[model samples]
Target: YIDFYNNNRIHSALGYLTPAEYYQQSILQNVA
Candidate 1:
């Protein structure tokens, strides 16, 4: 069973953003 909770699918924990998106946003924030 693939755990598509937040990591692969929309996660309510991260404001409905996937892990990749959240990570990318974090990186972008740091860069700026």
Candidate 2:
């Protein structure tokens, strides 16, 4: 499912952070 993938997919380029976590951190960084 898309939701499962978004929350669980690990990104090697992102230091293995999940897509959801990576996006969340990116947004926070951008806002800061």
Candidate 3:
């Protein structure tokens, strides 16, 4: 369930991205 929430579910607050997706994007942005 935790994995589903973080990696599979899409969140409106995160611009329709899953938490994992959002985190990855943030990390890329910070690195660049």
Q: lDDT (0-100) at residue 14 of candidate 1?
A: 82
Worst 10 residues of 3 by lDDT: 1-10
Candidate 1, residue 13: Cα displacement in angstroms equals 1.0
1-32: candidate 2 lDDT, tens digit per residue: 99998898887988899989999999999999
TM-score for all predictions? 0.65, 0.77, 0.89
Whole-model Cα lDDT per candidate? 0.79, 0.92, 0.95
Residue pairs whose backbone atoms clash in candidate 2? none
Task: Give the candidate number with the greatest TM-score.
Answer: 3
lDDT of 1 by residue, 1-32 (tens): 25465467887888889877898999999999
Quick one: ranking by TM-score, best first? 3, 2, 1
Error of 1 at 2 (Å): 7.1
Model 1 global lDDT (CA atoms, 0 to 1): 0.79
Candidate with best lDDT: 3
Clashes of 1: 0
Backbone atom clashes (below 3 Å) for every candidate: 0, 0, 0
